[model samples]
Target: MWELACLRFRHLGVSVTPSRCYRRQASSHIYIWDFLTMKRLLGLLALSSLLAGCASGLIDPNGYDETGTASYYGAKHHGKKTASGEPFNQNALTAAHRRLPFGTQVKVTNLDNNRSVVVRITDRGPHTRGRLIDLSRKAAEQLRMLRSGTARVRVQALNN
Candidate 1:
């Protein structure tokens, strides 16, 4: 006949097992270990994703020039927090870009009217699809695009 014994650990229901108790006790230990390991792996994955987002938010602005449709945002988004963590002010000479780093200054030229405005990159996007850059009300006004709401424009990143 075989003898069997189980020893408890700190009252956690965990036990050291002799042969007869091996299946039950060992399986519970494996489950606990697997759960903890899975949680740790998920935590690491989340942390890496956050770090990657921060790293990829910035891109080289050198020689960045493109022609695309531009639009403006105002009143509705005023006083809201931007991606850069600043309050959006429609009256400021600022703009939102998809790739340019925050604080980058870009020259926006309205191809139709030959009007231009220099704006600091402050926010994130135009939100609407197929748009190039989103300008503040003041920037739009400077570029003479308020009435039209959108413009065919050339954006050139300044070396600052």
Candidate 2:
């Protein structure tokens, strides 16, 4: 059965030398059928690892600990692309700052409500009037400022 499979693979331009294949199978407890199954399992594992990596955000550009207030941006600029080339999803637990760099984790506290939330700085902003930092919709909600839209907040840097 193994020989027949090898012959078919060879006919299809796949390289399946009998000596090499037998040697590989002999080194393990797996039979020829088991070897084929293991190969498919390994391929699936490799593909999943590649996909997991692609789903992550870019590396933080600012490179170290930094702190500032976190305000929220919404309505007028909900679907715009951020500095890291990701669409600004206001509902996500994200933030934007002028020089904090992407992926930096910050803890923002609302002075009025005494509420706080930690968020990742995933973009660059506050180019408007008097804003210190920009928070995602969810982060602002956690800070109890979604209704007001802006909060007087204290942002602290956290060490990874």
Candidate 3:
């Protein structure tokens, strides 16, 4: 049993020799804390993985211009933590784009009404297929797209 414990720890690249292994035999029950230790270890691994992905996925915003469907998220997501680690504010002029770096500002224009608003990229996505960007409630209101719920829009990244 001690050999198995040593082997398991070694599998995780941990230097656990036979002499360093702890064995507490309480009657017929032998407690192996690998389950608890692995649980916490896995959680840390997951968190680091997410951070690494976010760091690498940000793209250069220069010359980024596209026209697609735009949608807004408000009350339901207000005060929620955004991908940038800041709490979302529905009244703030902010937005989400799949690849634009956080803090990048973009101008979004509603094609139907020719209304436009400048919004900071604060979060990650629209999460819906065929969508180009996600706007905050105030941005959508300024763009005159609140009544339509969705709008055909042009998004152009601004140099900052």
> Which numbered prediction scores highest in lDDT against the true structure?
3
Clashing pairs in 1: none
lDDT of 2 by residue, 104-123 (tens): 78778888878878888778
Whole-model lDDT, candidate 1?
0.87
Best model number under TM-score: 1
Top-down TM-score ranking:
1, 3, 2
Total backbone clashes of model 1?
0
Error of 3 at 159 (Å): 0.7
For all candidates in order, the CA lDDT equals: 0.87, 0.72, 0.87
lDDT of 2: 0.72
RMSD of 3: 7.4
Segments of candidate 2 deviating more than 4 angstroms: 1-70
lDDT (Cα, tens digit) per residue for candidate 3, span 29-50 = 2333656567889999999999
- Candidate 2, poorest ten consecutive residues by summed lDDT: 57-66
